[model samples]
Target: MDNKVPYSLPGMTESFLFHESQLIEVGLNNAQPEEVPPPAFVPPCISIDVSHLFTTDQIFPTRDDLINWVHGIAIENGYVVLITKSDSGGNGSRKAYVMLGCEKHGKYVPYRDPDLVEGTRTQKTECPFRLKGRPMKNGIDRDWRLKVMEGTHNHEPARSLIGHNFVGRLNSEEKEQVEKMSKSWVPPRKMLLTLKENNPLNLTTISQIYGACKRLRKSLRGSLTEMQHLLKKLDGDKYVHFERHEPGSEVIRDVFWAHPNAIKLFNTFPYVVIMDCTYKTNKYKIPLLEIVGLTSTDKTYSIAFCYIVNEGTDDYVWALECMKSLLADQAMLPKVIVTDRDLALLSAAKQSLPNTSHLLCLWHINKCVLAKCKLYVGTDDFAELVMGKWGEVVDAATVEEFEVQWMQLFNMCKDKYSNFTSYCSTTWLVHKEKFAKAWTNHVMHFGTTTSNRAEGAHASLKKMLRDCKGDLATSWDASHSLTCNQHTEILASFERSIHRIDHIFMFPFYTNIRGFVSNKCLQLIDDEHIRMKSYGGCDCLLRETHGLPCGCELAGHRSTTLLSINSICY
Candidate 1:
């Protein structure tokens, strides 16, 4: 059932062809009736030697010239050579060499290492099919020439070179794209999928792309260790201090970094800051603690970041102490620190910045309440009660009113819902002053009631990184890039406020605000402007919420009810 085709080597014509079965049949018919035994079978030559093609003064003029020479020697002998590796370095040689690997399916095991670890390495296609080359410095050849090694290849010569990697090397343009995207942290599979849009399908594989990426990384570092490069970078950083394992160990347990510009920003806008941690972002097996400060524009700026040994109280305490050391001034300490309800971390913050008011993330508290209430009530009615009724109580306007609504809810759920009751008395009551809206509104928390700043930062970091299992060097590089991008965005916002703002507030009070505060703060004042109509009076909660005067307060100034508008200024 086999179809036969006339075959030829590279640069050679097709040879005579005959059906193998027909040839056997014809030989049998012409044989003697006594049919003597056939001669003993002999195997073909396993490798070709080309040492005679080179001399002391010779060299390969170009890559193609070397290939053509090798092919010319083998093509006449029923073989076609393929280049497995080439290193021209722009001069078509450098210690440069082209390797000859057996074509696909032409690959075979070396005579050595038989019975290797089953399924682990024995199945690998590491054919002993390679030869090195270099330019002939003293030979008559123009640039370079290849020499045949001493040992013969242990396997039979390949029949043809139709599907060989040597012939299917990547074109110049594709190699460029692979190198570019790989450095950008683009996955190899994604690089191929993207390139395949403009090229033939199956043109490249993930293995090839990954190889190129690895090659580039190696070339960039030459022979230096990854740690050597990292330490070299740290030498230039004045504000970032790293703590590695004792004297000669390999582990990097903790590292704290505060860019000089970030320190300046912290000094300028130290009123509100937040600390949050992200995990599984690096192979170093440490948690990244991010300290973000809220700018007057309500934008988030990275104040500092550190890698913690663990998420324990001592680890967080060390991180905060490092931050304090970076500032080296108590006045630069944040007036209010916002974070999730990590009690250990909160305790550390208290010890580190005794003057700083600690506030729990309102969003986290609400989410926890919703989760527990759903489990307690286990009905649609309970969800409605928690969301509609309990939500109002949590957002109560004053401490007195909050206590009243909380008691009412407690009275309702104290007996029937054991889970709900235990959560209230044990959890909510213990941390009510930190998490509840009633107590938190008194602090100037930059209006950030959630950990979304940290969450968004984490999402951006993940997008720039290929995987969470990257080494410490990889994570540091990615984080540095994102920090640059964030600062650029912050600069753009500053430009927008100065050059592109549209001030809708025409009144004198609003004009004073527009000139005095940031564009983001102006927007907050505008929201209060809208709220004053619904809840009229100087005692409006808007003043309490944002530390800004309400329309009622402005009206009091207009009607001489207050001596000075400065009285309303927080």
Candidate 2:
């Protein structure tokens, strides 16, 4: 280092001496540097075009101006603007844009678009007034439109009007208006206060109404009690003893009154009157008489009954007299009268209605046969044979035929039976065909040929009376009521029959014809034991065993046909 500085010291000594001498005169001044005045505070210069800021229709001018104006306003507010076409319309036109500000780069970059300023005034004006009025009118209009669209006025006004009417009366003007609008109106002249407010009875309204009602009810109850007392007093005085009359007098009157009604009822039908007598357990030995009639429509038998209390040497005569009284009217005479071949009843019928036919029920005839032929008619076949021939013997052309057939039938059975030839010829033989016809038609229809209607009726009556413990009067009343009920039932059955006939019989003949054919077929099928031939008449199996066709098959067939015909005819 010492060697390197010798030349520089010689060369620089002179220069340094010159500079050092010049720098010796310069003085140091320690003064603060004047603060550079803050650069003039320039407010951010914002240029807003505000042209095309809104839609064409929505803006006061063209769409471009509205859009640009909106874009410029966005830029001034520190935003960047970017223009792009809206995809909704699929048009290339820039329908919408975004604004980006110059402050994005930390500088107040004011946009200088001369084209926007020049074109702002020339844009079309769509509706300047609408655009200006939108903010203020939109809220009010939207609320009003919602109410209108919802039809809120229709219901609310109606409810409010109804509520007003319920509250109180309207003023004079309002009342007059309502009257003018209504078809009928009458207003009260005086305004009445509510019952609760008026307190008319000086009590709570509910208590007052209740008390008034109670008082009214008490008065009504008192009136009813007085009326009842008066009625009781009257009834007590009016009560009469029904026991004062002699029993015989009452019986006479009842018999007289019942006779006419019985006669009337009997005359209405082609009825067979059946009579029977039973002895009651009494000192008087009351002869219970029952009159039965066969319904021509249904063939069902019914009974009307009464009793006579008399016992003496002439008891049969008294009974006959009572029967005669019961059948006093000629119209009451039944077409056929059936009895047990009682001499007394036969004599009474001969006396009362000489024209009326009297038949010994085949039942009585058979009983007589059995009693007489105890030695001969031993077997049921012989008994049935005898009973079967009874009708034919009665209908014989001459007495000799009947005698011949009777003797033959008797002799054939004599080996194992009693000889009943004479008995069959005499007592059982009624020469009158009409009388025999009655036995054949009515009695024989039921197996065994018995008029069990009267016997059955008597048994029922006795049971009913017995159940009452032999209280004569109670039994009599109960029997009377029972008889009435029976009559009512019979009447109902008759009415129903009438209705069925009327309703069913009015159909076409072919329908009825078919029904008749069907019934015949059914009968043929049901009566399988009955043998039929093309030429010879059919022989009912029942005839050989029961002495008759048993009439069941015949009756069923006939009833079915009749009912069918009735239905069709009606």
* Reference-based TM-score of each model: 0.72, 0.39
Best by TM-score: 1
Q: Put down candidate 1 lDDT per residue, 62-106, tens digits, no spaces.
A: 656766666655554434456667665455333555676433214
Model 1, stretches more than 4 Å misplaced?
A: 1-63, 68-101, 104-107, 110-138, 143-190, 193-202, 218-228, 237-239, 242-252, 506-510, 513-516, 533-535, 538-542, 556-570
Best by lDDT: 1
Q: After superposition, how far is residue 95 of candidate 2 from its true place, in Å?
A: 99
Error of 1 at 36 (Å): 36
Q: In model 2, where do residues sit more than 4 Å from their true spots?
A: 1-264, 281-284, 299-304, 309-332, 375-404, 413-419, 430-450, 467-471, 501-507, 510-570
| lDDT (0 to 1) per candidate | 0.66, 0.41
Q: How close is candidate 1 to the true structure, as a TM-score?
A: 0.72
Worst 10 residues of 2 by lDDT: 145-154
